[model samples]
Target: MSEFFQQPPRAGNRFHTDPSLRLLTQWHLPDAIYEQAEPQLERMGALADEVMGALAEQAETNEPEHTPYDAWGRRIDRVRIDDSWRELMRIGQREGLVAIPHERAYGAHSRVVQAGLVHLYDPASAVADCPLVMTDGAVTLLQEHDPGLAEHYNPRLTAREGAWTAGQWMTEKEGGSDVSGTSTVASQDADGRWRLYGTKWFTSAVTADMALALARAETSAGEDQGLSLFLLELRNADDTWNGLEIRRLKDKLGTRALPTAEIDLVGAAAVPVGSLGGGVRKLAGLLNVARFWAAIGGPAGVGQLLALARDYAGKREAFGSLLRDNPIHRRWLARISADYEAMLALNFETAAQLGQSENGGPKELARLLAPLNKLACARQAAQTGSELLESFGGAGYVEDTGIPRLFRNLHVHCIWEGTTSVLAHDVVRALGAPENAEAFADDICRRLKNLTTAGTARVKQKIESELDVLMPLVNDPREEEARRIGWGMARIYQGVLLAEFAEWKKSAFDDDAGFATAELFCRRGLVDEPFPETDADTAGRMAFGS
Candidate 1:
């Protein structure tokens, strides 16, 4: 057999060959998955590399005021946010602005997309622009803030062509993540304007051009319903700031480049997204895509973190030996590498699954996996960042190394979207459906049976044990303990997936081994875990606050 055809297959590995860093070199996506997505990813790589390079340069300078900008001549341009905020807002109306420090939206989009991808289905109306809009939200915001740009509001272009930036209207003075407790009153004006009359705590208060605002609508019964979605455009008659006011910009520990603002709406001009009471549901469509983006971005950040660390280890000598030559450093690098691979495979699988989502309705499994991926990717990124940063000693603590910024940027992943606790609750919900969980688990079991690695077998046993604790709870419909038990079950599921992916990394070249490991992971994580709560009620509360 020829060299290419004779490639060996293992149980837990997912690659046609040993999955390596080079896997990204070729965007090998099935036509059904992303006919254009692979190309898009390729385009994004250049952008990512440029962004990383700019960050590296800025880090070397160690100047806080100097913003990171891609030195890449043209493809990736640099735009100053604070310097040119006025002009960029104008251009954003028509072309749409890209908003980075895209912490919340990124997490939301990534989680949703991850869920859809695992089921090989689409969660929204299968809208093509949804993904593009979510991905470009941060980028567009940067463009708008830069002085070189001009702002013009174009309703027609926005509705059709789609842009990368998005506005988040999630926080209320009463509660940030808890929408059920929201009291934002929405009344229809004589002129048919849906007026929102309430204070928003974190409205992207200043910079956001487009928003998915949540407010209560009056029903025929003279009572208010849960919430509704309003798409608000914040531009004016002479091309100036409309009614949306930026109360203040928050000074935060990380993502300093991305500004956070508290906003208030004084009879702000707005448009409805879908239906009045459908704000939660309508926003779900956008949020899903946002969550998926967040999940994937975490891994991307982790990759950048590891790359910088690896370079440092190879060159930095300590205690009369190269860092790589040191046993402790080697062990640390190995652990980080392994976690990184597990994260990548998990993120990629969900991405591939999302690319395959169609009209029939996304697989139910996707719903369950969204939280799992979000939890896994975010936690992994945070863990990897801390571990990798520690390996650098004092250099990791400073900005010049290019590792500290990554560490800072990744810290917020767990805070936004659906927090870790929220995700744990979701896993419990998935366990509620034993048949569904079992089917998901069974599929993984079938995959596990075909593996060759001892790691695969070990991981498989671990997953089975988790399912044993989870299955009964999932089957129970008891109301009082449902929420708590479900949360625990999700945690178990996540552990299984982590273990399974560990096996996949060890045997990426062996199809049988990889497949089995993937199965074991899915059975434990995706099939068994319940969906998490994304509503404001869960998000606004601190676990120990009460």
Candidate 2:
């Protein structure tokens, strides 16, 4: 009986196996840009199967440790991470994970290519992408504000060699998403150096060499306008502590392999990135970039979860039959797959727009879509992860199976960068811009114009109606109204993207998977239909129809 045990599930190169990802990228990028990125994508595909697959398991099991002092009681404040974690970082740097878009080697399509690579790498990298997000944002922020800072740090941040990552330290005890409540005070010293003097409550990736932080500068001004953005170097030129004290490392729910800590700044030497009064405005760039990365992480995680669950279903047997043969299980898997496919379309579409915006195209719609994408994808990833875990039955509950980690890692996506409630409010605020609202509505209309299917037309009408109901309330929305309207808007937008992409899939590849996914998304996600149980044949067709 023991010898007859089922063989462990094996995953091939994630990039090569994911047809949806390939098709989406092909549809999104220009031929010239795709040609430039093809080699890198192929390399990443192979690495994802070999290096990342093993490292992910090692990273979760080993986790990270915070050693505040050495054996002699010196204030070392060293974070001891698994060797696998370090190797992952090295791989990220070597692969130009952070450099590609910034380098712009592929012209206007750089961000599109970079986003595609991130979608492939993030899930297998064991959340190492968290710090990469900050690093990339910091590089962009510095480039826009202080060229000298960019010249000094951008090379190292994006280095494929001796790269050093950056962190974003905005959360304090008084404020999570509300940067206006930040109390960390920045004071100019006799040498004209700005020094931060307060505690940062939640600083992830404490191992970073430098961080972009928000601090209120001392001034006669009575308002939060005194808040400023500062660049704090964690270590000095002599490689010594720079008046930063690590209070303790956080015991987090997930991403445990990435060190997160609370720290007190006592005269921590810093440099101002932008004008003191423009901190919030300047930090917007970083927030947008971070939110975009957070958005991509959702579908990437969902892809991994679905792959694991589907593979497990094929192998695991119950009552003289494989789990994949169970009709009810297939239905559940199909629904999750449909949601995943819709999210991929929505995410990559946003990615394409972001690339265009960077290359001097329109920015208004991307601004509105970033937060919406983040909120929708994060929530869906968490829900799908939970469902995938359940499909594995008792084995999923055990740590050894690695399925539990998917759920644990996904939960953080909802809370990190910004909570769901915070993001919903952000969507309302973005909609307050009349031009942004107009652009969002116009884009949806344009995409829907190409889809002639009756079901799709109905989805489009429903979305427009929902937007009609929500648009008027954007100016002065109550919290409950904002949440309701924001979620509705996100669903409608996702449905539109799916419907458009499904049409493309049918026309270009003669694939019905996209249509099936779009149908499932609209019926269940937009119209609130109950889950349906299907026979094995119907279940297989619906779930894996693509």
Compute the lDDT for candidate 2: 0.81
**Which digits, one per residue and each the tens of the lDDT, describe model 2 over residues 421-488?**
89988887887778887897677778767778754666666666656665566545565466666677
Index of the highest-TM-score prediction: 2
lDDT of each: 0.50, 0.81
**Model 1 Cα lDDT, one tens digit per residue, 123-206:** 101111222334343233222232222133322223323342356677777875666767777777776677776777764323
- Stretches of model 2 off by over 4 angstroms after superposition: 219-225, 453-478, 525-546
Error of 1 at 57 (Å): 6.5
How displaced is residue 226 in candidate 2, in Å? 0.8
Give the per-residue Cα lDDT of candidate 1 at 261: 65
Itemize residue pairs with steric clashes in candidate 2.
Answer: 513-546
Model 1 TM-score is 0.68
